[model samples]
Target: MNTTNSIQQALFHRFDREQWAELRQSVPLTLSETELVDLQGMNEQLSLAEVTDIYLPLSRLLNLIIDAKQQRSFVLNQFLDHKVDHSPYIISISGSVAVGKSTTARILQTLLQRWPQHPKVDLVTTDGFLYPLADLKRKGLMKRKGFPESYDKKMLSQFIADVKAGHDEVLAPLYSHVTYDRRHDEHQPIRQPDILILEGLNVLQTDADTLVESRKPFVSDFVDFSIYVDAEESLLKEWYMQRFLQFRQGAFANPKSYFNHYSKLTDAEANAIAANIWDTINGPNLKLNILPTRERADLILTKGANHLMDKVLLKK
Candidate 1:
């Protein structure tokens, strides 16, 4: 292992991109350009090279961890002298919005499914657990829609618990970005998946109010592994603005889109709006809630200004 900054944070074992890439030798790229295009988010150029260097190694490491966990479960079951219920392994991917965590989740799901284990994998985003627009408005939290309080944390926690308890089927709400609301009528059925990847902004966060009140499990408690995507504040701001412009040119122009009004703005006007949103909402959320939990993740992928992962930090 590289000795750089090893003493800075004893809990994390850091590895540069080159070092991490070497760990994934001979792992063939399973995804083609067409599939990559569909899995990636808009405005983010995710090439096969990047997948091979970063995500492929990540998937390989996860396979090892899953194997180890299953072996341990087998021993425990034997010790108990009976069959013990072993739920699907859950992975939590968290980061600020527009940081490519969604793309990472999708890529991982595809890769893990292709592994020899042939585990049934399902991906769920915390967006589905957010309070409905009407509910947010009624609670006077419309402006803080992505904040922790804007989500039904109790319900979200319960849903994860049920899935982790080996439930046969669990129902989660569906959310629509175009409508910018939770689709209450639609429910996504998550059956007995061998692995469940839970991605969201607040998946790793614990409600501050819940700290002193109860011993309830937070959504993260059910996660067998967790990853956090990280980048400099300035770079994240730039990415957010770029994505906003792309949306203005595409989705925002649609009449049915919630942000349709933004399509009429000039580039300068749109930039100003994006800046304001970052400063007021997303920025604060990252500093206060999200980034604070970065160390809580089992692995942290640090990105450079170009959105390429430059370093990885694994919890020792």
Candidate 2:
């Protein structure tokens, strides 16, 4: 079979944009333009039409799933003649850098929380789980910042386990993009949220080496649902470069920002630097680590060159 035919026969049920939009049914658009603008990333162009067509239906589906799971738990508790503690339903979103994972996470968090059954949704990024700058430097992993080895996998896994065990309060480490490191004195307290959305570059990664060596569960193991945002490598490169340039004029311009030195670079120099970073770090990580995890996700959101989602592939 040809490549396209093989993909069509894969485990996912593919839906084009129009077909996916039709699934929205009667779901209302709860987000205003202002709210969507605030939720967008540096170079993203998220629109109300996109949310109405794509995210609303997704939210409705998630609501039904959550309700069904809760009902199942209740029935099981009755069968066991005991009250089991309720745990948060974890949803993980994974993708390459600049693939708009954060945008999708934030939008979903907002939409999912609006549902009456589960009004409390929390969002956390895996950046906070990355090792401190000093630790990375000591371990000689500075250049491999976003790689799986750079993260404190044990701590991250334990955190998920705690949250999944229905802990009354769990603290997640805080990360600062401005400083490009984890904050030692700060943490976000998660208090029994109905749903938790975990966003990261490698949340779905299941490295065989790590699993064989550690013999422990991966972070994705606790995730009840997972999504992967995807795009072609060329488009991802272009988006990364665009975001880098925008940051040079915006966030990098801050004197305290870790990347402040890049603010003074001319357009050509910035582009060169961005391209080198992508080619050396992000690109390799994507090809070796992130992309491999795409098929592991319960759903895949594929984007076009214009940074708009064109299709969805949901696991059958």
Best by TM-score: 2
lDDT of 1 by residue, 233-282 (tens): 89899999999999999989999999999999999999999999999999
Each prediction's total of clashing residue pairs, residues at least 3 apart in sequence or on different chains, is 0, 0
The Cα error of candidate 2 at residue 292, in Å, is 0.6
lDDT of 2 by residue, 120-167 (tens): 999999999999999999999999999999999999999999999999
lDDT of each: 0.89, 0.92
Alpha-carbon shift of residue 200 in model 1 (angstroms): 0.7
- lDDT for model 2 comes to 0.92
Range of the 10 consecutive residues with the lowest summed lDDT in candidate 1:
1-10
lDDT of 2 at 281: 99
Q: How far is 28's C-alpha from truth in model 1 (Å)?
A: 2.4
Best by lDDT: 2
Per-residue error (Å), model 1, residue 184: 1.8
